[model samples]
Target: MAPCPGRVGPGGAELLPGTALAILAGALLLAWPAFLNGYPLVFIDTVSYLAQTIVPEMPWDKAPAYGPFLHAFHWRMTLWGSLAAQVALLSWMLWLTQRGARGGVTPAAHLLLCAAMVALTSLPWFAATLMPDVLSGVAALAVFLLGCARPRLSRIEAVAVLLVGVFAVAAHLSHLIIAAAVVALVVVLERRVGSALRAAAAPALAILVLLGANLAGHGRAVLSPNGAIFLLARLQADGPAAATLRERCPDAGWYLCAFADRLPMDSDEFLWDPASPVSRDADGHPRFMGSVALVPEAQAIIAATLADRPFAVLRAMAGNALAQLALPQVGDTLPDTHLALSARRMVRDGFPPRELAAFDAGLQMRGLLPEVAAPFLRPHLPVLIAAVPLALLGLARGGREQRALVLAALVAIGANAAATGALSKPHHRYEARIIWLLPLAAMLALAPRRGRDPGLA
Candidate 1:
């Protein structure tokens, strides 16, 4: 084939025009609101972005510090001009992926891969919204592109890898698991501890710096005891069974009781039963109950629970993971006039009061697509459900060469699920951005050549 346009220097790979086309397509989707009121998409993205910006800086007195880099990015992105920065970062990622994937057995295949990435990642909602999720996606793509460019590390390529590591770390601390997975995979494939260490060094340092800053500024590390105590307090007061507990343990710290109640249950199950177990205190009037409050005591309880009910914990974790992967609603932030009208009509027709109320509320909140799209999209649920497994299969077939990339993606997704699953209302969107890996992995699977295959060029 004739040399693709925008080919780099002799040894460097050339960029494909397809990449530009994909980016343009995404840009067009993002710009839809200029003509049509893509309010839902815009609204969802805005809320998520706003949450990232406002929630983190709520003063140490309000909420515990979590995902510091995500919060920082939100703060900085807005201050430095929001939408423009988002577009620039996305464009840079597209360019990087295209350039990095050049010369990797098939240029056209790589270009097509880029197109697939655009298609999968073109969630118009996220494109318009200024959230760390977009940055996280870019960081992930950078890592993947760099890994694909392996076996030859130019000075620039080496720098890119390190920068990606740092960016990934700073983009989301949840990225730590993914980063570690990638590094481990690289080490296993290349058998070069030095390269693996180098790739991970930047992110590792970035994490430490973030932790140091948190400690210096807020006097607490991420997930520090004080933070946990705060979360426990929230869980107790605003949580299920708060009323019952308040009546019993008027003077007792509900945080400990809430922790005890939730310790045995995953988030999903906890949502079902918001009330805690009640017991009598020394005064005997059915006081709110909890285990000992000492750190060692809590640790002992956790250890005992794990030891006695390992299977249950594993089952809860598995179920929570599945729930996190499934998209609950298509466009959560937008209003669907269609659903709202339907809900209103149903109410007029004397539908069950509670059911109609739920429908009305859902219509008002999520709009029609997510509310009504289910029936139409039900058949596709199988495909969505199979994503994680297919990805694992791709990893197995990808051999040692690509194992690192696969493992890194897996670790990131897994960690996110684990962490979020422990909290209340584990929504799919929390980890939705990572869904880009599904299509990316599928592209890798369908690629014409296996880099490690002995028969390949």
Candidate 2:
């Protein structure tokens, strides 16, 4: 019996075998866990999640500042359960991509897209983490997919758009930067400021909801400008001023201190100064030990640093992003390799108890396949560098245009690489999540068929 042409809905069409395969592949990857290890898998963000779980009432510092939605979820779920939430989020991304493909793509093409996405192993690993990275990634993908799927969407479709926008804001503050860029693109393409403003309602509403929730839950706006200023201040301060800033703004300084603070002085020498103007707690420890309260004066310093060293900042960010992409793991432990193994042994055997404990906990894990995988990944570096050109080509190809998809792919890759190079360790797993999109973009670029343009539809 020939299948009655499987139609989805009023405008929906039949599914292709390739699309099914892609979805199945994604599902299988999502379900696989045998090779996964719990201890090493838990990155710094996972530690933040653990802290949140243990102390539900603790206000979020900058580290895991995902707000009440994730916090609420973490409070209710165990570590494994939280990991499941990440999986669910990954599934959401897959589903959104499928739905977004719509008229512009055949079932087979859609499936191929999904398969390509699944091929990016980093996506699943990021999904497995307890951090907001998965949520932000899903949100970013959703925003792009939704934009591609419906050019002149109905009210109901707008609701979905609104949800994506809201999720973007609530997921992670940094994602808002990407979302803003996307909105600007839509504005330029649509050529209607009013329409762009209307489209932006979703994200705006999301921001409002986040603020309202923060106020309701914590009795203050979670990421108030003042709080940000204070945090920045502490980040810029040096020596005695920095110490005073830390003492005054413990919450804002907590995450910064946890991750930053590379000074060579002993904790006792710096932290236990009796004559210092900074205030101390009951134990004679600095009151702002864990806080990251931003101060106006410190903000001025950060601003000056940026202004004075803009190029350096850019270079550092770029370098950090590259480093992060090359690094094996984002966690706070060194990779288990011959060199790292020897170093770990030396640290364990020779270092003092306190120093050894710190070194073991602070060192980042290296990648298992960096030497082999990095070269294969390097070809995709062009995709990031030439994203604008690739996107233009997608646009030129017209109907069922893969330009937006390609753009999303590039954004994911370029942003990941650029960001990792700038801020975090370079790890292949981190790059793996978005790297497959590069080849997919190239494939779309090479394909001969001119399908229905997503923009036109």
Best by TM-score: 2
Predictions in order: lDDT: 0.44, 0.46
Estimate, for each residue in 422-453, the C-alpha lDDT of model 1 and write its tens digit. 33235656565565555455445434333221
Q: Per-prediction RMSD in angstroms?
A: 10.5, 10.1
The positional error of residue 357 in candidate 1, measured at the CA in angstroms, is 30
What tens-digit string does per-residue lDDT give for candidate 2 at 22-56?
44555545533312432123344443434433444
Evaluated against the true structure, the overall lDDT of model 2 is 0.46
lDDT of 1 at 109: 44
As a whole number from 0 to 100, the lDDT of residue 246 in candidate 2 is: 42
Worst 10 residues of 2 by lDDT: 1-10
Poorly placed runs, candidate 2 (over 4 Å): 1-25, 31-35, 38-41, 50-54, 63-81, 98-112, 151-158, 193-195, 214-287, 293-297, 303-401, 411-457
Query: For each candidate, what TM-score against the reference?
Result: 0.58, 0.59
Pairs of colliding residues, candidate 1? 7-14, 40-334, 240-274, 336-367, 336-368
